[model samples]
Target: MKSQMLPTIFIMTLALSVCGVYSGKVLVFPIDGSHWINMNILIKELYSRGHTVTVFRSSGSWYIKESSPHYNSITVEDVAGGFDEDFLKMLISRIIQIQADGKSSWKRLQVEWELMKLGPVMTQMEINVLAKLLDDHKLMQSLRDAKYDLVLADPVGASGGIIAHYLNLPLVFNVRWTVHSEGHFAIAPSPMSYVPMPMFELADKMSFLERVSNVFFFAFYEFQAQFLIRPLWATFTNKYFGPDVDYFQLIQGADIWLMRVDFVFEFPRPTMPNVVYMGGFQCKPAKPLPQDLEDFVQSSGEHGVVIMSLGTLVSELPRRVVEEMAAAFAQLPQKVIMRYTGEKPSTLGNNTLLVEWLPQNDLLGHSKTRAFVAHGGTNGVQEAIYHGVPILGVPLMFDQPDNLSRMRAKGAAKVMDIFSVNRDTFLQALQEVLHEPFYRENMQRLSRLHRDQPMQPLDRALFWIEFVMRNKGAAHLRTESYKMPWYSYHSVDVILFLLAVLATFMASFVFGIKFLCTKVCCKHKSKLE
Candidate 1:
């Protein structure tokens, strides 16, 4: 009986070790503030589910340090030496130099500037440079030593995707906004369609000229892929890593793509098989607003409060714009709190207060805070929606225009061009949003829709992660479309049909001429006989 009991105990212990314990490690890379927030929530969820999580982020990111107690954090060093400062100086010097030069040189400079203005192309170039840095053999050896089972990367991180390819591990990509899906064959709508171009200016729509511009933009991307990106990536991978690392292979290695956008704010579109929409994962009804903030709102009397932020990256707006905004707020009946990183404006009025930073979620959730004036970043947009606050978006760059346009189309916000912005238009837009209850009602309706999903976004993300681990890769869920030719993917069969029709018409014309010539010769021969 003692021997039998010993055997039973051994079997139980082995089962517990094998089945209940997971040894897999997940490495996450978030490049910016928004990505940091999204990945932090995902890391916490992964940790609670009994997986070890590690994070890599940019050096200056605040959220990475804030999340140290929750997960292992590593900062990517700025290896380019004083590159950022030097780069800015060079840009300014070039501009001034070109201005002093003759018209031909200035025209050349303008052309170069236009090339830089193409956001997607510039982003791709930056991604290529980072990919080369990450492909260094030393870095690869270090990652290999870590023995991670999977790598989770933000698409914007650039290097992570390439590193995952080198390590031969399953990679999951996180896109924090809508425009990241451009050029990828996915069901998501191209948010770039909403961004107005200089050739075509309209609200909530793109014109024919805009469509033509997009075609040229797409062509430019392809050009970069063939000429710049492909060669650079190949050389880096071959020199430091191995010959097997290729651009197409890097894209194919991704097991899943996660987007941080809710379906409520976006229209239903065809989605790829492994693509998942997990937007608003970080949003929740946070703890009550601080007592002082609440008291301030309560003391504002019948007039409401306005929450204004330029987001993290663009925290310092031009001083003139700040003064104009302050002056505009002075006239409005609302109590305004502006989040500015630098010195406060000199003309700040009685109804307004300036702070370096405010707890954004807490302020947005306050009942007195009726509207948000924001830079149209995804994090800010999601928080505004979650708290049922309307927005007046002053888009800066990249996807902000598209994000703002989508909100306006939903009847939940208004968009103001930042360059042309002033006190009168700003005040009128603010009053319209606060005076009309429709904006608030629309936001609430969208919030309910977003919150009505079958599973909480974080839980859904966790389930997918576990599912991928258990299955040893989610490759079965991936689509064959990834293997299809570019023309086939975009459905160019109609063009082929038109070409075929043209060919048949030309053939029939040649055959008719031959037949007529033959008949004329035979008739002439009969007359001679």
Candidate 2:
């Protein structure tokens, strides 16, 4: 038996070795911070699969490192400043302050305006980087010479799509958001009647008033994209590409969009063929925790532990909010582990442990973890769903509220407005999630459903990426509707033409009947005479 097994093992090993040799070179343009976390997972996977990876990072990148064993880094010097931690922290604080003014229309607009300010800044930064990259003759020549197989990018910024177009490389997007709108809105048919726009925090099912609001929100974003955002990229687009080139069109024309979400987390809506769902692709079974953390988990005993983290961008909340949260955590019987960089809250209990960083995935996967208190980032929410941990969400900004809304709709989470959250309210929400069996049960069921797929989300994403590279592009899968003008794509012209033909036929028939009647009447009159 041993001799027979050795031969089989050798055969299998040889086959695996042969298969691994067919690797392609991938050029990555990733967004910094939490977005980088998702992109980095793919890069690591590609590296493990024996593919060569090269990362393009701005000189002032926040989270993206200059050195990584998984990929080579090409730093874009003096191009433009990438999003750093301090800038994000300040933005978050301002948004929070604005939100405290209540939910009146004027207040909402104020918040929107605050958020809208980022559009020009980020767009301009990306355009500057694109221009700088293109202007450098040596760099451009080297890029062309290297002949990368494809460009994998997060399209929150347009630089990647523009560069991909410039190089004529096959493009794959690791996307949730695009420069203009949500990823689906960029390519898929999103009927505003049901498909809620991002930031609205509405669910798939909506009331009549909600639908109206959805439409209004849709229009607002459309206006922002067209009038405000699109024009910023025009000068660069015209200079490098042609004047006829549309920047948004280049984004829509990507070969594949590896959307970082799945049906489990996303509302049921129309999606494109090339749009692959890879929700929780960064998730994996938790490894053993660090010894100190393990001791804490062991100390929880039967009561279990509650873990909290606001993700990479905004670790520290306002001092008052932190105090409120700390007070709430103090009331819980379960031990708490929270990630905070702010001053330690005076109300904080001995049961709660504050750390500068926590291993979120490992903590969530622990059997002792009772619930998660989070700010409703996609990565954190998906991880909770993946690990079967229910969430108590304090959605701060951006898609956070919307994400929490989905979880709440699914009965896997309970959410409260961060501005409205007090010690009592926070404790109540947390207690409900901790005490309710349905929360855990629903999340576990979702976890099972998410896990029951034939292949891992990451594996699916990798296969499609390789599929694109092997074929030079996934043009067959991508819809050519993006290339068509709006009237043509929507078939408005065809509908009008059909209507005109029908009208012509009707008019001809009426005229013919009238002429025949007139002739018959005249003949009758002549016979009578």
- Give model 2's TM-score versus the native structure: 0.95
Clashing pairs in 2: none
> TM-scores, in order shown?
0.78, 0.95
Candidate 2 regions off by >4 Å? 1-16, 79-82, 101-104, 520-529
Q: Taking the tens digit of each residue's C-alpha lDDT, what string does model 1 give over 1-529? A: 9988998999999998878866568887665555566777887778876788888654544556735655787655544332233343344345434433223545544744544444344355455446545656686588789888788887653466666776777888776431223413333334456533211123435577766666565555556556655665577668756885565556655787787776675544456678777877778776687787777778788888998997765546566677778888899888998888766887688988787778898788777888999888888898888888999888755456667777887889988865456789888888888889999899988888888879988777777777777666788777656456668766698689888999999899899999999999999999999
Candidate 1 colliding pairs? 187-270
lDDT of 1 at 87: 44
Query: Top model by lDDT, which number?
Result: 2
lDDT assessment of candidate 2: 0.89
Q: On a 0 to 100 scale, what is the lDDT of residue 342 in model 1?
A: 65
**Residue-pair clashes per candidate:** 1, 0
Instruction: Report the poorest 10 consecutive residues by lDDT, candidate 1.
Output: 195-204
